[model samples]
Target chain A: MERKSIAIDMDEVLADTIKALIEEVNARTDLGIKEALLDGNKIRHFMPEHEGVLDEVLREPGFFKNLEVIQDAQEVVEKLSEHYDIYIATAAMDVPTSFHEKYEWLRTHFPFLDSQQFVFCGRKNIVKADYLIDDNPRQLERFTGKSLMYTAAHNIHNEDFERVNNWKEVEKYFLGNEEI
Target chain B: MERKSIAIDMDEVLADTIKALIEEVNARTDLGIKEALLDGNKIRHFMPEHEGVLDEVLREPGFFKNLEVIQDAQEVVEKLSEHYDIYIATAAMDVPTSFHEKYEWLRTHFPFLDSQQFVFCGRKNIVKADYLIDDNPRQLERFTGKSLMYTAAHNIHNEDFERVNNWKEVEKYFLGNEEI
Candidate 1:
């Protein structure tokens, strides 16, 4: 049987991006904002100056390279890869400069996946897959397939799609009681 | 009426890639290969050393940044953008390093189009649009929408799909009698 393809988002879904951003903020300033303090909101909301600082960091060349992977992401995604076709669909166009970093990041973290599995674009609606795993509700808005919302602090209130809080839940949703 | 989206290819369709590649070969070695002599084939097919030299060029940082645009592509694509939702889709995954250069190239040549319209991916099958105007037949193979094969020296023998010989024909096909 042909394995069903799954399009996975990189930022918060696979990589703990907000946490990294928060860390960058803490390292730069005395904001000392913990991930827990974010409480399902972006840093810009709590940032004192705001002034596009976070956006500026995102536009930097290496911001996306060293992002820590979400908990259990590697093992679960490897398991999922065995059962399904996996495509890493990232909206990298929003920060065009991050392309090389993001590509290198994916190559380092998701080494099993090749360049063919990467899709760097702005709009998620055009991605063809049996399922789209994303955190942003707007990214899932126009998707024609099954939408699986990956739980993140910022997207906690979005109740429109099936939510998977962590990689364990993702494995359960896709693999369903199969031992990993 | 909402404009029907067209996913246009960047290589042979919008940019004269093979011509540039041939030029690169002539610059390096004594292979006096001209675009017409090859008569619808790739640079590697005629290259004497053929030992991944062209692939090396493709993988370089700035190769895609300076290639010449296909004649009339700017005017016709600009005209098409007004009538159709234009998306510049390039298979940049084949050369991951080329992402930044490709984005910069697009920005320089097609400034009217924004980041939202750029898709740098490997598989053309995943791109959803009303029509995919491309040069590679394999790219059109899995596309579910209408496929228009843009003429190129290499793809001349391809008999599949409606062929658009040049940007003029592309304008004629889409805009028809409406002046471009």
Candidate 2:
């Protein structure tokens, strides 16, 4: 059987990048902003005072280096790779050092993932694939293929992906079996 | 090996009871609530006119007669039952008709689930089991056992259940390397 292809979003999909960034920025010099106000996925809300925080936090030693993989992502991807051409199609900004660090971390943790398959694009809606695994609701609706929303641990905004809480369902949907 | 006992929550965990309730109430003759304002776990800030609508909705046929199951729950539960003693532990108000109807609906859909194991209680936090699968974060925190939060498709409040998501992780935590 011809292997199916799966494209996964980067931020909040594979890694808890947003949470890490929020923690790193807040842990450092306080931006003097209310944490509750900056609770959700509105990245630019904290960017004003915590300028350069996103870049610095993502590049911090053991930031991306020590990122915890999404629950069951490693297992699901490994199993899916057995039957699918897996690709990391992300709507990530072109922050070279920070983005490269994420890729390196993914390579280290998910060694089965091909480094070349990681496509760092500004908009994932443009990409065409057999299946797309993303956390963004807007992006999910745009895809014609089977899509699994990667709901990050702290993301309370993308309620649409609530059904796709774990990688097991994604595995079941894409791979057609839950045992893997 | 002694089989592990698994506790399943009823509301958003097993059936789409909340959604059905909203739809039922909205379709009523008097209450003219245009949209359902379902919040993170609790349905707060509903139209004042819909106060009694909540009660009336519970009496509707579709609300009690044909509640939908959460995606992939039946499959996961059936497979899990192969290695576990599955029990339905739900927190239900003593609405006689609604209660009986829900029980009947559950029995009808997931026939593999032993009706004898179903226990409807006032508070799920007080329930005891080896494993508890629930969507409510409060229930998860209260239950000391290995609990897996049954995440909804648009939960938006997913961060709370980051530690546990899929049944595989729940199985791994409870059953270890025993072949399932």
Candidate 3:
């Protein structure tokens, strides 16, 4: 029997990229930008003056490597792995340094996922999977499969797809009454 | 209209990895193993005394980066890109260092191909496409697509799939009676 495949985005879906960005912003400058102020996906929108700050932060060697794992991501994904082909597909081309860092980070955090299950590419449109869970609506918008919007500070306002605010919600949606 | 997608392997199919291995063996050891003596995909078969030489060579920093490109791979792939959704799917997880090197090498050599077209993956079975051109019989064996065996020194003995000896044969099979 063919197992259903799920392609989960790394940055916002599994990794807390927004929290890291906020921490970096607060640490580097006196902007004191909080998560509440981060309304959209583009960091530049909140701080128009700091046009290149996001790019600078992304270019840092450990920016992606040091990101905190999302709550329950490891457990939920492991559960899903048993019933489906779980793929952690991340758009890592923007920062060349993040390639190996992300790979190591996945291995460190989600040891259950083998190296073969990781798909590091630039776009999500090329991915062929039965389901995609991502924070970016643009990625979900282009995906031909069932797109589940994983809530993030930047994507809270976007009501374009089926939303799953947390990993518990993800578990409920897929497993139905199964305990995590 | 949806274009037919073709997933092409990188190492032995597009890049001449055997040449690089032979060069590395000659440069590092006194055995001076030639291409004629190398029997299989694994280098350990030829050098029984140096059991870990293959792993050592693969772990080297520039092993995948400095590989020579297979003759006419660039031109044939470019021609194929005109009609099909061409994807360069390489099993890069064996060597962690290969992730970025393969990405950079693609950018440098196949300038026409964009970052979105490259799939740095582990198992080719996870890939979804209408056709797959690869040298590894294991990868092609499981792929649920039209598998075209790209002739490589290691895979030349395998007669499981339809064979394409060189880029000329590939062009003949695809763009028959049509000039590139």
Candidate 4:
């Protein structure tokens, strides 16, 4: 039988994109938006007062290239790679400019994965795998396989899918051992 | 029931990539390679003494951005979109630098497709669709859905899958109408 595969999202699940957004927005506009301020919605929802500020920052050339690798993401995913084929699927079509930078960032941080294991797309559901670990529920729309929701500030309230708060939990969920 | 979806490849299938490569290689290296010179072989296969010429050309930043669109591709795919959801899946992972350029090329040529319909990956089989239309047999490896091998100079000898010579033929294979 073919080994089961896992498709992991890039933004919040593996990369600390929200933290980078929060930092960049605060630097540009003095929005002073904290992790708590994000609450149950995305940074966009809080930007009604500062219209397009988030987009403006996100559009900067090197934004995604500088995002911090989420804690334990590289190590846990490396461990997970031993048992399941791992594909890093990112919705890059939304930000056309982010393509090359996102790829370079992955190469720098997750060097263990074959370059072939990377997938950049818009509709996450189109990625066929045994399991999908994503922070966005909408990205999982109509996916036939199991969906695991990676905890993000904006996605904390979403209860429709199985939730794993961090990479430690992800390790335990897949490998039954969080000690790694 | 959801409408059946078709995932089409970007390179030789929809974009006149090999033709562009031949033109560029001939201009730069004075190889004078022509359509007939490429008889059932890729431009790279003929470059025994000129190794890395193809790689250097492909690595150029604007190479993918300036490719010509295959004849009748846009109109036929537009008609096919009416019956099946359409996704343009490209193996951009092989050429990390080609990612953004390929996306912009599609946007400029196939304006009817939404940004979300684009998928860039290394393994084409990861894309879930009712049908995958591609020029490379390796890209169709292990696919569960029906596969159509779009004809290219190098892939002409390949008969592992159903073949369609051009966009008009592709229309007939899927839509049963080549009139467009």
Best by TM-score: 4
> What is the Å distance of residue A128 in model 3 from its true position?
2.6
Q: Give candidate 2 regions above 4 Å deviation.
A: A31-40, A43-48, A59-62, A141-144, A153-162, A176-180, B1-180
lDDT of each: 0.86, 0.64, 0.85, 0.88
Residue clash pairs of candidate 2: A153-B159, A156-B156, A159-B154, A162-B152, A162-B153, A162-B154, A163-B152, A163-B153
Least accurate stretch of 10 residues (summed lDDT) in model 2 chain B?
A: B32-41
Poorest 10 consecutive residues by lDDT, candidate 3 chain B: B36-45
Q: Write the per-residue lDDT of candidate 2 for residues A1-180, one digit (tens) a residue.
A: 756667777666677666666677768765644435654546656567666776677656667666677777888888888887777765534443344466567778788775656654444433446778776777778666766666553355655543466788887877678465
Candidate 1 CAPRI-style tier: high
| Candidate 3, pairs of clashing residues | none
lDDT for each residue of candidate 4 in A63-153, tens digit (9 for 90 to 100): 9999999999999999999999999999988888899899999999999999889989888768999999999999876566899999888
> Which ten contiguous residues of candidate 1 chain B have the minimum total lDDT?
B42-51
Ranking by TM-score: 4, 1, 3, 2
DockQ of predicted model 2: 0.01
> Relative to the unseen true structure, what is the C-alpha lDDT of residue A64 in candidate 1, on a scale of 0 to 100?
90
- In model 4 chain B, where is the ten-residue run with the lowest total lDDT? B171-180
The worst-scoring run of ten residues by lDDT in candidate 2 chain A lies at A91-100
lDDT tens readout by residue for model 1, A1-180 = 878999999999888888878877777777788877667676777886865778777876678987899889998889899999899999999888889889998889989987888999988877888899999998898777899999887888779999999898999999995663
Model 1 ranges off by over 4 Å:
A178-180, B178-180
Q: Which residue segments of model 4 deviate by more than 4 Å?
A: A178-180, B178-180
lDDT of 1: 0.86
